[model samples]
Target chain A: MATYKLKTPISEEDTRKLKVNDIIYITGTIITARDAAHRRALEFHREKKKLPVNLQGLAVFHCGPIVKKENDKWIVVAAGPTTSTRMDLFEDEFIKNFKIRVVIGKGGMGKKTTKAMKQYGAVYGAFTGGAAVLAAKAIKNVKSVEWYDLGMPEALWVLEVEEFGPLTVAIDAHGNNLFEDVQKKVEESRQKIYQKLGV
Target chain B: MEENILINEKIVDDVAVKLLQLAVTELPRDVKEALQRAYREEESEAGKTQLKAILDNMELAEKTRTPMCQDTGVIIFYVKAGAQAKGLDKIGYALRSATRRATKEVPLRPNAVDPFTQKNTGDNTGRFVPFIHWEIVPGDSVEITVMPKGGGSENVCVLGMISPGQGVKGLKKFVVDTVINAGAKPCPPNILGVAVGGGADIAMKLAKAALLRPLDEPNPNPDLAKLEKELYEAANSTGIGPMGLGGKITVLGVKVEYAHRHPASYPVAVAFQCWAARRASARISSDGKVEYLTHKVT
Candidate 1:
């Protein structure tokens, strides 16, 4: 339950120190990416094509924001984390290729992602799922955006943020995953519940 | 011998916007109270933290008049139509116009996407969107309720047709299994709506409609009320807790709705509503007097 404030371009060593249940607040750059964004990023990696922006040493937020153009600038209205499990298929490859240090999202990722975190040095931070406005308060600017053709939710949104979190490290660099841990206990309890219900 | 006010497109459009505003920006009183209770009863630090953040987020959204969650979700309108109400033909156009207006004015995220093209409609409306369900009732007042169905929760809704021999035990097991399999994905602590004994479509429709029930209201049928209580306890006992981090509250409540079966077919549908649980309703009389049913709006 230790708390930390970290800036972007975080080193592998820094991510390695994070443990399950540790609280972290990140300041600096984070990009919003969901299902389509992940597919495109991986497609580009396979083709050896350069992406519009380099994501190395940064945080990737699983979010689809409500944004509007006001006076020729983008204003982020609500930018909360989407369910991270939706991106589980792409996460392993995305981490290996992009070298992102922090992954902020809700729910949690899968075994592939946990193994990747241990190998490449990354942590999964769980923000409260429905707290969109609070999440938006930390965002200071839309640094830039790319792949608008993918639509807002699936587009790549580069954002500059302040101390933007209260994120719990649900998966850490050492292969400890809070979600998997909970799932195991839930299975054990379900057996007992089934016995009682006579199902 | 009766005095009735004429209903028109203008009034319908204006009222729809007000309903949309309240639906996205304000959580209902019953839901807020349930979350507060979960916060007080939560045992683990992770559960406590999640509930606290949710409560704080509600206050912020209400104060700032912004959306509580980014999804804002797909717009759904439930209409209880009055047979005697005028301008029934204008309701569709007014509601569609209202959806477009709210997308820009309420700044609601345009979430409607065409599955074939994989392109967003950008205004949250397309073919059959802002999907309306109409029920004719014996009254002179038209009531409209709006529920924004988010992708996370909607993605997990399930339907199962089981052998009639399995009966109640099998039905209950299916629900608990659904909750376990859903895990943290639907963003538990969830409010579950379950429908039994209808056709697949009917069961799903009834299940979603059941979610409009306030948390404090139990089913009038004593047997159904008992079933809801048992399921609610079973879900909370699993320790999925808030955000599924393992604690004392996996579900805030369970709501069950059912139709008499076809003797051989037993269809069960589970509708999952995340902890946000947002909806608002309004009733308009023939004389055009509007009353906000869910929230106290000025």
Candidate 2:
């Protein structure tokens, strides 16, 4: 339940201090990646080929940004977090191999991801689900992009942002996941709710 | 008696593009009011915070003319075309052309990809990417509704085939279980459209089409309305709250639509819409006049 101002290239130490339900306002650079980009990154890792961008100590955002090309420059129109769990299968490996310290997305991840967060000293931050315009306003710049062939949603977008969150710490570095907790609580109280409804 | 309404192809094109633009940039009045109501009644600070952010985002998107969410999603057209309307054959081409224009102009994220080869279409339209569903009505005007359903919520959609003996109770259990299982994935404070009794595909279509109705409006059937109310209360009581951080309002509204089913089958489908709930509609008269039903006619 604590509030923090995080400036990236964050460390394992900084991420470890984040507890589930805590709030964080993040600053500095973060990279965006979704399904296809992660798959490509893994392929590159297996081949021992150097990635287009170095991700050490950086945060990764699960987002598919709406960008337009104007005067040879890319303008981010609507950049919001996508569903993070879609990347769960590749995330643990993505975090460990790329040294990603913070993960920003909508929705919380599952057991494997939370386990990876604990083991790798990473925390998952959940942004408001449908707030694309607000997120776009926080971006200071689009530093560069890679994997243009992967398309907008799957491309690697390196962006510079300032105070880029009010993100809820859904999965903390210690493996506490708010989503899992809510599911358990709902299960415990399910009978009472159903009875109240007379169903 | 009506002299076959001569709907111009050009008018259909203009209306379709307008609907796409309006759907992405503006949160309809009913949805905005519902979110405001949820914010007012939310009991938890975390839930309130989530709602506040969403509201702020809505405001910014409207003012700045930016999209509400990045996943402009697959553009779906629900067309209630009139049987007597002229230029019926040209409607599909107009819708597709408008979709491509909107992909660049509304600047919708290029979401259409080749499923087999994994190649982005760059424009949102591919082979049936801007999916169109046609239903013929008695009227002579074409009414088109565009819903920009995001991937997050669509991925969590559920279809269940329950035993008829299980009845309403079984249907209720299926719905509640689906929402709980969705957790933060579909984005809480969601709008649910539940369809019961239709065949598999028809049930799924009914559920999505149900989302076209305003949140303030209840189902016309008393039984369905009652079911919606009960499900809303039960879902909120789960405490999944907004963004699943824990709160009192997991679902803002639920709309139920049911169709007569075969004696041997009872299929239920739930279409989960994220808090964004982006949709808008317009009608084109045979004389080429256009009126936006959801927003101002201008």
Candidate 3:
């Protein structure tokens, strides 16, 4: 319901102050990780291997960015969020293991992730779907990348971003979930449509 | 023979690459207008913010010649092969070649993967990738449309086989339920394409084909047009809004297509196109004249 500007490595206290429906613009480092990257992170964690970057207090974006090599430097062309629901399986554990503060993506996650956020003091922010160029505009630099064998989209992309979102807080450190709230409203309307159509 | 080779390989490749560029970077006028209308009309603040971001992203993408979305999507070519056109057989090959070339130039995400090995094709070309659908028509010009359908909308596709007696009402219920079940997953303010009748596979094809139609056009069939309008209204009533965060305009449009089915069957299929509906097309004459149907090219 309110807007705030935050920088990362955010503390638990920073995440705790936000509520579902609050708007936030982040100025910090956020890494891109999708389904494959999520699975690999968990697998690597179990194997007791070192990750390319420390995830603690960072925003883990559910994104598979479009990137290109330009004069030997990697540039992010369009780095919008991928759907987050696909990572629902690993997210609770990801939060528990990584101590990350925010999960950024399109499409909200499920109950398990919400519970993890409430327990671990994290939040879910939704970037507009298909708004890739705007996303790239905010990405000041592609600081580094990993897991290139999983291909560009699935690889771990380290991005340095500035004012990187109008990311609407859909799930917060408390138990509030905006998607669940909207689903209830939709169900009520679905009934009326059925009644009128006699279906 | 030289003329044939030039048209099939070079002209087709140029057209295909340019079409891909335009399709990904620029939202079609009708679809852009629809999003603008949704933005102006959306009452909810969250929905408006979502729409504004979408519009701004679109503008930036166009200005910078960047892909509008990171997904870029699965490449599909809906081709109108003129029976009278020369080198009709090579159109498919040309499209595949063009896909590879476009993949590098436009830098499309390499989406095609070998299912068994789980490895990407790197060039966006693989077995049955680019998924061309061919239609033969009564002219010397071949029309090609490139619709890069994103995964979010593709995941929400549904098929229903209800009792034949339920008719339009059954179809209505099916669509409403599908959209609700999809929630925010498909990215709301979506455009839905519904197909009724035909066999199951045909029904699915018809439904996806329905999405190729522009938002500005109503179904030419009067009864179907009315059905489209009613479904459009029913869908928006769900108030799923942009990204399903809650708002009044859940769907921008609903298009319905039909075929006569077996008396016992009432197969219905629905395909969803997310708010970033992207497509562009061009037609090439047998004599080598090119007409850009969707957008004017310099």
Docking class of 2: medium
Rank candidates by DockQ, best first.
3, 1, 2
The positional error of residue B37 in candidate 1, measured at the CA in angstroms, is 1.1
Kindly list the per-residue Cα lDDT of model 2 for residues A65-162, writing each as its tens digit: 87778899888888888778789989999988999988999877989999999999999988998798999999988999999898776899999999
Answer with 1 or 2, whichever has the higher DockQ: 1
Candidate 2 clash pair list: none
lDDT of 1 at B147: 94
Write the residue-wise lDDT of candidate 3 on B1-298 in tens digits: 4464324668998899999999998888999999999999999878888998999998888888888888888999999988877887778888999999989888788889899999788898899889999999997788999999899899999999989998777788889899889988888889999999998999999999999899999999998899999899888889899988889988989999999999999999999999889899998987788889887688
TM-score: model 1, chain A: 0.95
Per-prediction count of colliding residue pairs?
A: 0, 0, 2
Q: For candidate 3, give the lDDT of residue B263.
A: 96
Clashing pairs in 1: none
- Residue B140 of model 2 has an lDDT of 76
Scored against the true structure, residue B21 in model 3 reaches a CA lDDT of 93
